[model samples]
Target: MPVLISGSVAYDRIMDFPGKFVDHILPDKIHKLNVSFGLEKLSVNFGGTAGNIAYSLSLLGEQPYVVSQVGTDFSSYRKWMKRQGIHTDTIRVVKTDVCPTAHIITDLDDNQIAGFHFGAMKYSAIQATVVKHKVQKLVKTKGAIGLLAAGNLDDLLQLAKLYTLKKVRYIVDPGQQLVWLTAQHLRTALAGADTLIVNDYEMDLVLKKIATTLPKLTARIPRIIVTRGSKGAYWYYGKKRLTMPVAKPKRVLDPTGAGDAYRAGVIMGMLDNWDPALTGRVAALCATYAIEQYGTQRHAFSRQQFKQRFYQTFKQQVSL
Candidate 1:
């Protein structure tokens, strides 16, 4: 089944800080604070919510379509996606602008600070709407799944509306954009979603913004997945809550794109209708692989290797 992934496509300039973030700044001086850290390592890689998730889905044997807008410098990323067998026909090219770029710095303790330039991502809504016919056709594809990840807020809402009208199952992932999305916008984006995925911090923000508790939110959202970094994730459906533990990794090189990988795993499980607990474990294991690699799309694993690791880590066998 093809997955329609809508979000930003960017170049991630990732760097590593040698020390912990907390060691540098004082809480009392937090207001009007100015600080800089000397980076120990830096590397630029292909990333963005859509690209990262689609890359992992490709590894899982899904030819997902990336619905996004890229800048003139997208040739390299286009080649990379072709190599991974990902579909880019829906990705609009903005000839006048440069691609979106994110400068992410991670500390030794895994805390991160990022500076993002919207660049061509700002035109996402325009591009998406202009290609409505193609998008609608894909939405009607048999067994196709839709993922509205973080990107231009307008584009996210637009895609949500289309998905609902087409009666396609979709997941809403309001990540960094949570800070900018208004209550009404959030409601619109999640109105008809099958699942809502966010980190623990973003979960709290959502509840606060909507002035609703978890129990109340789940009554309407059907399912919700709250990822807690090292603590794993919590899956809430109806009145039941499942706590999932992390899949231990051999080494934690970087945690930049782990969440996107987890989302891909969730989509895989959803496509197969796997049990929630099992799906979460698969998602956790997928995230572990991201942390083991330096960049989001750098990890590679065959189905056999993934299955072997699945058994080794969780002591359970999985077909994929």
Candidate 2:
């Protein structure tokens, strides 16, 4: 059974500003003012929710099948991912459109402002190739696990239902689209998911609208992980809650895709049938790895390196 990754595929342009953004804005005229700041340096990288997760998973020895849409210009990236052992047979190429692009600006304080152009991603709603491939794969494989990271809410929900009926254990990490999901759709996805991962603020919002006790709510779903930046992460499996502390890195470089890295680690540990404590520790270690790197996908690791770091931080041996 293959690990299927479903999400958006986009080019990320990261820019750094020399000064603090607070100095440029006046509190009283905030709503009425329009301003622009020049960036000091810019770097472009291949990224998106699913791509980041799959990259980390590949590093951990899991070959994941990525179901996403990209433009014709993505050939180079596809070849690169293939070399990394990621299966991209299900990725649809939009010949007439450009790939999705995200422009992110980060200030000295690590705050970010971003604008996105959907481009090829806009056609993702109408693409049947990726969805058909995923459905066929699900039907043919037993005990497959799918990660639904990005896409149109309707499409994700429908696919979630289809995969659930086919008996695939799946995790849903709805990154930024949580705000757009309807109450009914959210409930349906949550109910269908084997695991649900989200950050602290998103967890609070979900708790407010879901109207159920967290413990009881998670009983139906096998695992729930809520990440808190520096403090670490919380994992709830039914009534059992395991809190893992964050591993302090020698340096904090970029916080761009740390969450996705953490998700990948958790999935890797789960696949190994490790206990929740070990699982959370694996996630914490992966997060620290990303924190110490400038770009999201620039970090590289050997299995020995991961094991050494894991034991140093958690004081436990990870038996492979």
Candidate 3:
């Protein structure tokens, strides 16, 4: 069975600002502020929640099928995906549009700012037609085991509903897309999920929006893994709770797509039937590698190397 991933596929345009942003802007003149900072350099990288997760999963020896959309300019990115061994049969191409792009600028102090152009991603609502086709096909053929990552709120929710009706199990990850959803939609997404993954800030918002405690939410969802950057992660398995400590990397370079890497580990762990501690620890190690690279998909590894890192960090052999 293919592990299905439903999310966005975007290009990341990164820029470097040689100086601090605080030097040019005055807080006192906040109401009427207009300033420009010349960037020292610009680099483009492949990313997006689905792409990043699939990249990490491929490295983990599981090439998940990506249910996403790209644009007319996706030729290069399609080639890149092929080179990385990612299965793209389910990706829809909007031939008249350009792929969505994330514009990001980071100062010397590591402070960053970002702007997003939805482009093809804005038409994510149109993805339902394709998803319906794919889902029907999957049901007729192999069973569906999937990941509902960040994407169009309606699209994600509808797919979740469809999968539920079909008795297909999937993981729900709201990522930053949680802001685009409503309390009702949020609750719908959480119901019947095999696991729910979100960062701390997202988790707080979800909890507040739903008017429920973490324990209560976990009672329905089976598992909730809340990730904290440097502190690592927290896992709530039904009524039981577990803490996952940070796994040290050789070095830290960028924070982009670390969450996606962790989700990939979670998917692998769920498939392997590993315990929550082992799952989160393996996820932490995966995230450590993500932070060591400038681009989300640039990090590379093999099972041997991952097992070695796992043992080095936890002092336990990776029997899973």
Candidate 3: 10-residue stretch with minimal lDDT: 123-132
Q: Residue by residue across 145-196, what tens digits does model 2's lDDT show?
A: 8888866555577668777787777888887877777678778787678888
Each model's lDDT comes to 0.91, 0.81, 0.82
List where candidate 1 sits over 4 angstroms from the true fold: 125-130
Estimate the TM-score of every prediction.
0.97, 0.93, 0.91
- Model 1: lDDT of residue 141: 82
lDDT order of candidates, best first? 1, 3, 2
- Cα deviation at 199, candidate 1, in Å, is 1.2
Cα lDDT of model 1 by residue, 1-320, tens digit = 66899999999999999999899999999997999899999999999999999999888888898988899999999999999999888888889998999999999888999999999998864355556667778878888789999897777998899888888889999889899999999999988999999999899999999889999999998899999999999899989999998999999999999999999999999899999978999899899999999999889899889999999998998887
> Which pairs, if any, clash in model 2?
none
How many pairs of residues collide in each model? 0, 0, 0
